[model samples]
Target chain A: MNPSARQPVRATTSINGMIITVASGKGGTGKTMVAASLALSLAAAYPQQPPLYLDCDVEAPNAHLFLHPTLAEQQEVGLLIPAVDEAKCTHCGKCAEICQYHAIAVLGKKTLVFPQLCHGCGSCTALCPEGAITEVLDRMGIVERGSAAAGIAFARGVLDVGEPMAVPVIRQLKKWALPRPGQVVIRDAPPGTSCPVVETIRGSDYLLLVTEPTPFGLHDLRLAAQVAKELNIPTGVIVNRENGTYPEIDAFCEADHLPILLRIPFERAIAEGVARGKTLVDIHPEYGDRFRQMFLQIYETISHS
Target chain B: MKILLTATSPSIDSNVDPRYGRGAYFIVVDPDTMEWQAHPNPGIGASGGAGSLAAQFASNQQASSVVSGDFGPNAYNALQAAGIAMYLFGSSATVKEAIENFKAGLLESVGAPTGPGHHQH
Candidate 1:
């Protein structure tokens, strides 16, 4: 395989606007908490330059749960799929033969079109000599925008629960969530280093990978770190639930000379706050201070480099 | 067997036109004959990596292999499952060029076709 073809698109980190991603390898690692608090903390520290919070975890998007932004705008994200015209189609099995997605199948006199495999690319129709195929847009999901209580510009993408693709919805949300000049953007990415996570962090200037102090955390942290390193984005570790668990994160950072931005200790209040859909910065203001410190350290590092 | 091409497209005009679908086309080619066909994706139920419903459609076609401009993870996986091999084109060339490349044996196979019906929907 050609190396360049498989290579991921490089994200530009020189832009003054910062994109800090809150990502964890495993679920329930307080990734969302760290992401939300970072935004709130940044807003409080630089009230004039409040941060914009984007919840890219379309699978179980909960940034809205914490920020609870009033719905300002909502619209459906769509993907184009092919529909067969029986009148024009001879069921010559040509469409099925040409379909790379296997979305079109001709059986006897009838044919079935699978709506999910369609990438909306027009190769099939163009190849059809009979002109039996047409394209149609299908609503994939909804992207919502609003303002949070803290005046943080809020955006979240919710892929229809069954929809397999989150990138399209994320792409749409990102279009609206582009960092305005001088605005710090905090993105709470989906768990795991998958396509959705890649899409969430694609244009980020900096990534704040939030992992816990556990064996699983370490394992998933490695995966998350690999993703960050693959993207060549400058990243730091923010250890959440820093209780009596593995300290390997610190060792990993020290060994790699990676900066340990900040650590949020395990606390019941944080859990309760999350359960209540309340921002931890509001639930417990002290955590906000630590988050601000984390943000400042990241800034200083970026400035130095 | 005469080759057929399939893709997901939402517009009839676009299926025939080469400009839409981001220039991505699904080409099903008979490996032996190299004769092929094309279809544009309609973009429905096509989400979530390649879906199971899509595998069913491919199984129905008994497609030997699929060639396309791009494959989202879902579609990629779904196609693999249906006992169909997936080949990525060498460049953003036209469907005609892709066919030529495939016939000339210039393209590369990404992976063996995956198990069918892996997609839930």
Candidate 2:
């Protein structure tokens, strides 16, 4: 099986707006590469309705480097944190008792709030007995929207340095980059199966998981597959650096009934190209047609299910 | 003067807990009378801001001094704001021994935070 053997297929069926999210449980498994190239391919296949590419890895977003989108709009994302009014305050300790994160602490006459630990649930402000607490906008990150090659619609969220939470930023990016009718949405998710990853893959039509052939990769892939199972989402695997040595990934996928959608072998030229900030389709033009075929197969599976 | 000490258990014979934020027990004692009351630390299993919660608990007990191995930034700041002095004690010392050392001026007074907050990597 030659993955590069191009078989051109006609684009006859309309997708009617489907969200496809590319993710991996382990870091540095080529998630951004696969996602960016797929979006570009889809954009080329349907010039009338370009695909929307969203970079949901707010903590360390790098898809913009590959897409090179000329950002035309930027907006600040924030969360509502609590602010205490000392003048109208009574140190009743109710806010401290109610907080589950321990973000707020009340002592004799002092009320202290730790902004970093806050989840922005607005529980402290709403439950304050003396009406001393008010909600304040705490800036967490920013969202940028632009256009990339082949007129691919691009958007990304960048979280502030040292910020612990990325869910709000990802949520804001999704809202800002909502897809139109008959358009496909491609999301580049962050590595790992944590809250941020779950936030990115939620409400998606299909999940494409990328993994390498290694023990570390296999360990995290199982965890990621569990998350997809719990979410009840249709999922497929893309094995990067396929060196025929690690058959455990194949065994796991076979037992789990997950199809191997694509396999990108370990090649020095491919690594060098990607290292120079080149997409897979840029180095090998044949990949553009292959990705289109992959999308059509995914659409077929989704339509039947 | 009343003093707070981080301990492993509710007894004076228990060894001192090195961690101030996630310590097991907080014992308030008066060296002069040797009278003390032990309270389980409420911040033992807190997900975040454990230091601040522990400092608030210490202030509520009206402790003038806190004896622990290390004080995180949040606990140090909160204790300073409440006019409480911080003292460093050996991790192997018993709660009773720490109290004796505090009276004998053997424990070292901390000028700044002894630890970066646990939330930081």
Number of the top candidate by lDDT?
2
Scanning candidate 1 chain A in windows of ten residues, the lowest lDDT window is A1-10
What is the Å distance of residue B86 in model 2 from its true position? 2.5
Native contact fraction, candidates in order: 0.05, 0.47
Candidate 2 per-residue lDDT over residues A3-46, each given as its tens digit: 22123334444455778999999999999999998988887777
Model 1 segments more than 4 A misplaced:
A1-16, A92-94, B1-117
Calculate DockQ per candidate and list them. Answer: 0.05, 0.50
lDDT of 1 by residue, A213-258 (tens): 8888888888888888899888898887788567788888787666
The best candidate by TM-score is 2
| Candidate 2 wrongly placed segments (more than 4 Å) | A1-13
Could you give the interface RMSD of candidate 2 in angstroms? 2.6
**Positional deviation of A302 in candidate 1, in angstroms?**
3.3
Model 2: how far residue A78 lies from native, Å: 1.5
